[model samples]
Target: MSVRLQLTDIKKTYRAVTALNSVSLDMMGGKIIVLLGANGAGKSTLMRILAGLEDPDSGTIQFNNQTTDAKSIRRVSTLVFQKSVMFSLSVYGNLAYGLKIRGVPEGEISKRIAEALEAVRLSGFEKRRAKKLSGGEQQRVALARAFLLNSNVLLLDEPTANLDPNSAAIIEKAILAKKSSSRIIIMATHNLNQARRMADEIVHIHNGEIVEASAPEDFFENPKSEVTRKFINGELDF
Candidate 1:
């Protein structure tokens, strides 16, 4: 069965600054929702909340029509940050850690690790030290690790930002390959072209609020909000 997520009246503040203001969004499984925004527009903040890494000051989250808390959300969500973090271990070890803790059998862990690495174009790098690889390679390994979880919600914050074209392309392909009826993929990116290519729906955020949400064709060609139009045309200052 498909899953649904709803965030209602979300508000967050960091001391004197407001990060999110009365934000509400509904997402369903099997779709790619891409958030577009400038720096500090709350895209990362929202993703963090969804991933259960952080909590909104005030909000209600419903997963599959039932209210849930951060811990429950965390159980079903996987997040990949723009700056990937790696353990001081080999690629195989890093990928296998989560599976082992979940009580997956040794044979299945090996098979899944191999498949995940191959998906990220890192096949045969199992013996390499994760922390010693190039930045792009590390990010790919991070993506591979997330893939092994097969979480119901996949949250990506600029997953392909600042990488070589080949690495970025490979990551995008692997992400698309993982889309299924039982999963939801939400990504935040400033790369308009990448957003256009990967997004099933484009959501524009500004100053901690959602200004517009529409399909890629409508969002790029005919934005309704003046703020959205300016953003699309590169007139809004970050």
Candidate 2:
């Protein structure tokens, strides 16, 4: 797969706390790279920076062979937060808002919405009030919304966190279904098992620094770092 994004010496700090420290990695298209870390281990921070929701204190973000602005970056990437945010609109409205803003034709919008909802298994939910849906349903809607954009990169922060097993399974299926050769998916998760299921590559972060990066098989069977081993064995607490 080609490199979709490159982060060089990325750093982010909040007051005295450093959220990332000289981090650098190349993200390739057509694969799911799971960021494995406990809470506050900088997974969310890294994802936020990638999504252009937050800027790094120091670093350069390169995309499509050029340094890009946040607007340009965000234009081709979409972030789904752990806590779903739905505008006070129906599911169709929520899904259509971004396309509408881009002035997509109504017929194309309808086609994309149908495909996205089907991908997320929410075919009959278009008229439901987004805010009135259950947490799991809302999360699925969020996934559908992102799928509609068909962005080059998809950034998900704890996509299945606090979800029931069935809900989590649905989200996982949606994620897998949405994969394409032109798209890159990066997901943050504390669950080792989920990472094993979804990740082609596993990136381990601890105390705001990346300690190990490897394929899922190697990461699970032959972890190179003490921190990674501890995390896999459930010895470390978030």
Candidate 3:
């Protein structure tokens, strides 16, 4: 598989405390990668950098043979924030918002919106006001919005957090159904069970540094680092 994104010598800082310390990795298209880390481990920071939400103090984010702004990076990739932002519109309106922003034709918008809503199992809620939906439903709308954009790289930060088991399952099904050679799904998850079920590769971070990077099966079966082992054993703090 071809590498879709390459990070080299990446570094980010928030004042004196370094959020990322010289990290480097290559993410290829066509796989689900779970970024595992504890609180304050800088997993979110790296996702922000990859999403072009924040500039790294030092390093490179190379995509499609070019380095560009977050907006450009954003065009080929999408991020699903933990918090869902619902506008004063119906579920259909929110799902079609991204296509509208990109100036997709009305015909295409309709098709994309229908497909996305189906994927997230919100098919019949087109007329429902976004704000009126439950938390999980709202998040499903957000996921539909991102999926409608048809991005190559999808970055999710705790996508299932604060969601009920059924809602989480629906979202996971959608994610699994969409994995393809032209797409990459990277999610930061604290739930090991989710990682086991979704991740092709695992990235374990500790105190802002990558302590272990391995295939999910190997990582769970034989975690090399003490920290990673502890995490799998449910001994680490949430």
Q: Pick the candidate with the highest lDDT.
A: 1
Per-model clash counts, in order, read 0, 0, 0
Q: RMSD to native for every prediction?
A: 0.8, 1.3, 1.6
Comparing 1 with 3 on lDDT, the higher-scoring candidate is 1
TM-score of each: 0.98, 0.96, 0.94
- The TM-score measured for candidate 1 stands at 0.98
By lDDT, the candidates rank as 1, 2, 3
lDDT of 3 by residue, 54-128 (tens): 888888888866876667777788888888889899988888888888899999888778888899988889899
Cα lDDT for residue 229, candidate 3: 93
C-alpha lDDT of all candidate models, in order? 0.93, 0.90, 0.86
Instruction: Give candidate 3's TM-score.
Output: 0.94
Off by over 4 Å in 2: 1-3
The model with the greater lDDT, 1 or 2, is 1
**What's the CA RMSD of model 2 in angstroms?**
1.3
Model 1: per-residue Cα lDDT over 1-238, one tens digit each: 9989899999999999999999999999999999999999999999999999888899899999999888999989999999999999999999998888899999999999999998998999999999999989999999999989999999999999889999999999999998987899999999999999999999898999999999999999999999999998899977
Poorly placed runs, candidate 1 (over 4 Å): none
* Best-matching candidate per TM-score: 1
**Cα RMSD for predicted model 3:** 1.6
What digit string (tens of lDDT, one per residue) describes model 2 on residues 1-238? 4547888899999999999998888888889999999989999999888888888999899886689767788888999999999999999999999999989999999889988888877888889999999999899999989888888989999999999999999999989876777888999998889999999899999998999999999999999999999999999766
Quantify how close model 1 is to the true structure by its C-alpha RMSD in Å.
0.8
